[model samples]
Target: MDPVTGSVAPRKILIACIGNIFFGDDGFGVEVARQLMIRRYPSHVQVVDFGIRGMDLAYTLLEDFDELVLVDTVSWGRPPGTLYLIEPDLELIAQAGERGVFLDAHSLDPVKILSFARSLGAAPIHTSLVGCEPESLGSEEDEISVGLSPTVQAMIPAAIAMLDKLVAELSFAKKVEVTSKGAT
Candidate 1:
């Protein structure tokens, strides 16, 4: 409860948007953050465009959050613009760390970041990934492209809808947990 407001403070939720806007469809996460910013969210929800700053994201993870949602483009051999709600396995992330898989300073790898955060004894209680399949990563000329491909661009609405649903579910779960604790 907040002393000044005399109201219960909401559980903190961090929506980390990971992507490189210059790499065509790799900008999916950034765009999602942009769109979400214009909309209203619960007081405890923070939507940040982390871009490709892996180190910054790693440090930010130390600030505990009830939930962390990562938005990015994932290539799973699916059709372009396909959206996926993934629950990353923490054990698998730890295993990857043991295998010597590491994170690049300029690249945002959600799994790697989670593993690193765990190493530092700081990880969100719940972590989820909201990914979109990309048509292209702008590898043609090795130069940056400023926008998403048509296929990927078309799925922004779907991605936002999915995010809204996830946030609502998490918020409700948090409320239920608080109520149960009080009852106990």
Candidate 2:
């Protein structure tokens, strides 16, 4: 028996972390997603640590998902260890635009992935981002940057808290939407 055929579709939620783990702060997404998976999130939440694959993100989004959260280290002109939340600003994003960036360790850039998602109509209406100041982009030792340092690691708890809240909001919202649709 195909269990999935009879089962209710999992209410989809995708949390994607995109970065190069070898490049210090650039690895924030992979690390955070890794830690997050250790927890018991709702059955619907699917977390993926996309390491440095940006262009491929579009394919992932093609899956049925009510909510999607993308995680990456972003430079907001802030000093290292600083963390920032990127509000869903499609215009701001399109304006900022995208270009290919090569990592000594990996492939693809976040902007390119987002751009692809946008073009494909695969984007979730409620999208958000967490950006961390990158202290180191390249180094042989493969150490977390001094700029990101110990202080920055402290931010992970807060970021996780933020993720929890967002998930709850989307979960509740989806429920309400589904209920409303069934009623009509």
Distance from true position, residue 163, model 2, in Å?
1.0
Provide the lowest-lDDT 10-residue window in model 2.
Answer: 175-184
Q: For every candidate structure, what is the RMSD over all alpha carbons to the true structure, in angstroms?
A: 4.9, 7.0
Extract clashing residue pairs from model 1.
none
Give the least accurate 10-residue stretch of model 1, judged by summed lDDT: 175-184
TM-score of candidate 1 to 2 decimals: 0.85
Query: Evaluated with lDDT, which candidate comes out highest?
Result: 1
Candidate 1: tens digits of C-alpha lDDT, residues 34-124: 9999999988899999999987887888996877889999999999999999977666776766776577876887878777776776743
> Which portions of model 2 show Cα errors greater than 4 Å?
1-11, 92-105, 118-124, 139-148, 174-184
Residue 88, model 1: lDDT of: 70
